[model samples]
Target chain A: GAGVSQTPSNKVTEKGKYVELRCDPISGHTALYWYRQSLGQGPEFLIYFQGTGAADDSGLPNDRFFAVRPEGSVSTLKIQRTERGDSAVYLCASSLWGTSTGELFFGEGSRLTVL
Target chain B: GESVGLHLPTLSVQEGDNSIINCAYSNSASDYFIWYKQESGKGPQFIIDIRSNMDKRQGQRVTVLLNKTVKHLSLQIAATQPGDSAVYFCAENGAESKLTFGKGITLSVRP
Candidate 1:
């Protein structure tokens, strides 16, 4: 793809339900990132993947939030027992090499609304 | 805990006028900085980036100024157009390859 792509542009789920958001990064890009953005705020780091392994997951917030990139190209973010506080936009980004320069390309993002 | 934050919450500029948005960061160890623009229902797009080694960088109609002494960053947009209306964010790359972002500022370009 020309740019990073994300699925389920908008998802409204009841509290305690499980939801998954997917991201397809640009072809040949090896670094992937997941971020969460609440209304009126900037994107917050969630997880970062260098290839199929998670290089960092310190920003996951809790055990309910998890992400994986099994093939290194596409990634998925899963939330278990979603809470109303989880309502926000989940963003995905990719970089050619690493985030050394902070120049990662971002996707449209998936809006999750936990009702 | 180091963090980045905007000086203001909103900036309104007239079409054809110049616009400047300011940001402040607390971390002195940050080596890289980037400016991102986000429109409604879309993700953030990179505008310009400046390394700690450089004080300034310029793009098509945008310029980023970095002042490490005070940990301040600013984005300047020339001849702002209606299409330029969007939210702008300043991000800093810190430890662990993580980019910490500040709360965005809304840029409103009046016609």
Candidate 2:
């Protein structure tokens, strides 16, 4: 894709149901990240992947949140047993690797609405 | 608990006037700071970024100032326009590598 692509621009799922958000990063971007933003708060980091390895997953709120970037290209964010509190905008970003200062390119974001 | 925050959650500016948004970050090891502008129904767009080594950086009509003494960051918009009305977020790239954003400041430009 020309830029980072996120699937399901909006998702409305019932509480307790599972949901998966997918991200296709820019070509050759070795670092991918997931973030969650509530109604009035800043986006909080969920996970980050360096190539196919998750270098950091410390920001995952609980065990229900897990993300994987297999093959080092596309990544998926899985939410198990979603709760009403899990509803928020899920943002996906990608950047070149090796440097921490590389600017991140963001996708349109998946707006998850857990009813 | 380290946190980044905006001094004001919202600010209103007159058209063609200059606007200033302030932010405070608690991390001393932060190497990079960035400002992002997000409009309704859109993703965040990068405005400008500044590294801790440099106290100031400028972009198109925007300037970012970093003050290490107080761990503060400020975004100054020259001649604010209507299109500049959006939520601005300040993110700090701490030793953690990824960016930790501050609670956003909404910029409202009144004509």
Judging by TM-score against the true structure, name the best candidate. Answer: 1
Per-candidate count of clashing residue pairs (backbone under 3 Å) = 0, 0
lDDT of 2 at A112: 98
Residue pairs with clashing backbones, model 2:
none
Docking quality of model 1: it rates as high
Worst 10 residues of 1 chain B by lDDT: B91-100
- The candidates' interface RMSDs, in order, read 0.8, 1.8
DockQ for all candidate structures vs. native: 0.88, 0.67
lDDT of 2 by residue, A34-63 (tens): 999998788899888999999999999999
- Candidate 1 per-residue lDDT, tens place, A1-115, comes to 7899999999999999999999999999999999999999999999999999999999999999999999989999999999999999999999988779448999999999999
Error of 1 at A78 (Å): 0.6
Q: TM-score of chain A for candidate 1? A: 0.97
